[model samples]
Target: MSLALDIFTVVMVVAGLFFFYAGSIGMLRFPTVESRLHALTKADNLSVGFIALGVMPQMAEATDALKLLLAWALILFSSAAASQLIAIAARRNRRRDP
Candidate 1:
């Protein structure tokens, strides 16, 4: 049981890290601001969720796990809001420039 939990944690964490790496690559490789923002937000959001889930099993207490999940939820909301704002600004700028 312990080994299974450990393996699950490791797999989730690795998946999260992979998404983070992919997001970074997208940020660098994407040609347009909208595309880059889309990639980054999507990947990062998933990465955070995965990492939070991975860490939850390692927590010693239920409250601790709940707290971690709450944090992840907050991050999701904030990131979504932030990404929307950025996208709006990018669109506005594009309109103004052209």
Candidate 2:
């Protein structure tokens, strides 16, 4: 069970990194700020979330697992809020300029 879990966790981390890469590429190549924001927000949320969730299972103790979960929650909340703020800012800028 532990071995399988380890493999799964590794895979999740790798997937997260893949998302990060995709987001980076999209941000670089996309023509518009809104399109880039879409890639950045979606990819970052999924990548960080999956990676954090994977860490919870690999923790050595229940307390550690709880801590990991809490950390993950905090990250999720902050990232979501930040993304919203960025989106709002983008919209405001677009309205002002367009």
Candidate 3:
């Protein structure tokens, strides 16, 4: 069972890595700030969550897993707020431009 869990963790980590790469490429290739922020926040949040999940099974104690999850949740919330702020600012800039 533990071996299976380890394999699952590996797969999840690899998937998260792919998303991380995609986010980077998206930020570089996307033409608009909103699109880039969308790409950045969505992919990054998933990447961190997946990484935390991957590490959860390996933790020695239940509290460690809980801590990891809490950290991911906090990051998710903060990133969402930050994305909203960035989008609002971008929209304001667009409105100001002729």
Candidate 4:
């Protein structure tokens, strides 16, 4: 059982890291602001989820796990809001420039 949990945690952490790397690549390679934003937000959100899930199982107490979940939720909400705002601004700027 312990070994299984450890393996699960490792797998999830690796998955999270992969997403992070993918997101960075997308950010650098994407042609447009909107596309880059889309890729970054999607990948980052998934990475955060995977990392949280990976860490939750290793937590010693229920409260600690709950706290981690709460933190994850906050990150999701904040990132979504920020992405929306950034997209809106980019749209406005594009309109003004052209």
Candidate 5:
């Protein structure tokens, strides 16, 4: 049972890493600021959630798991808010350029 949980945790962490890497590449390859923001925000949320999930099972105490999840939630909310602000600024800039 412990071995299975370890494997699951490892897999989640690896998947999260992959998502982060993909988001980085997307930022470089995407043509528009909006697209890059989309990729970054989506991947950011997924990666953080995955990492938190991985940590939850490994934590020995319930409070530790809850704290990890709470941190992730805070980060996710902030990232989403920041992304919206950035997107609005980008849109405004585009409008002014033309």
Candidate 6:
């Protein structure tokens, strides 16, 4: 039912937040840029994705669902591309340094 859906959404959001926090801690504790990036990518993409998916079913209408889906898609695409670019830049810098 709707109540069950709401509870699920809330749980998903909380789980996502936990992941984000975990990632933040990992990034801070990590010794290298690459390690930090790994933490960042894991946290950013998955947390956002989990949260978005959680909210998807609660959307009010078809248009609202579409909008949410579009937003999720944008986040997914951009995060992946940005992560790749960051990796490339980091690798390039390492190459230049040694």
Best by TM-score: 4
lDDT of 2 by residue, 18-46 (tens): 99899999999999877887888789878
Q: How high a TM-score does candidate 2 get? A: 0.80
Tens-place lDDT per residue, model 1, 1-98, is: 98899999999999999999999999999999889988899999999999999989999999999999999999989998998999999899989997
- TM-score for model 1? 0.96
Each candidate's clash count: 0, 0, 0, 0, 0, 0
TM per model? 0.96, 0.80, 0.93, 0.97, 0.94, 0.86
In candidate 2, list every pair of residues with a backbone clash: none
Q: What C-alpha RMSD separates each model from the true structure?
A: 0.8, 1.8, 1.0, 0.7, 1.0, 1.5
- Per residue, candidate 4 scores C-alpha lDDT tens digits across 1-98 of 98999999999999999999999999999999989998899999999999999989899998999999999899999999999999999999999997
What does the lDDT read for residue 69 in candidate 5? 94
lDDT of 4: 0.94
lDDT of 5: 0.93
Report how far off residue 63 is in candidate 5 (Å). Answer: 0.5
Per-residue lDDT of 1-98 in model 3, one digit per residue for the tens?
Answer: 99999998998899889899999999999999999998999999999989899989999999999999999999999999999999998899899993
The 0-to-1 C-alpha lDDT of every candidate, in the order given, reads 0.94, 0.84, 0.94, 0.94, 0.93, 0.86
* Global lDDT of model 6: 0.86
**Residue 11 CA error for candidate 3 (Å)?**
0.7
lDDT of 5 by residue, 1-98 (tens): 99999999999999999999989898889999989999998997899899899878999999999999999999999999999999999899989996
lDDT of 6 by residue, 1-98 (tens): 99999999999889889989988998899998888988988787788877887898898887886787788789878887888898899889999996
* Clash count in backbone of candidate 3: 0
- Error of model 1, residue 13, in angstroms: 0.1
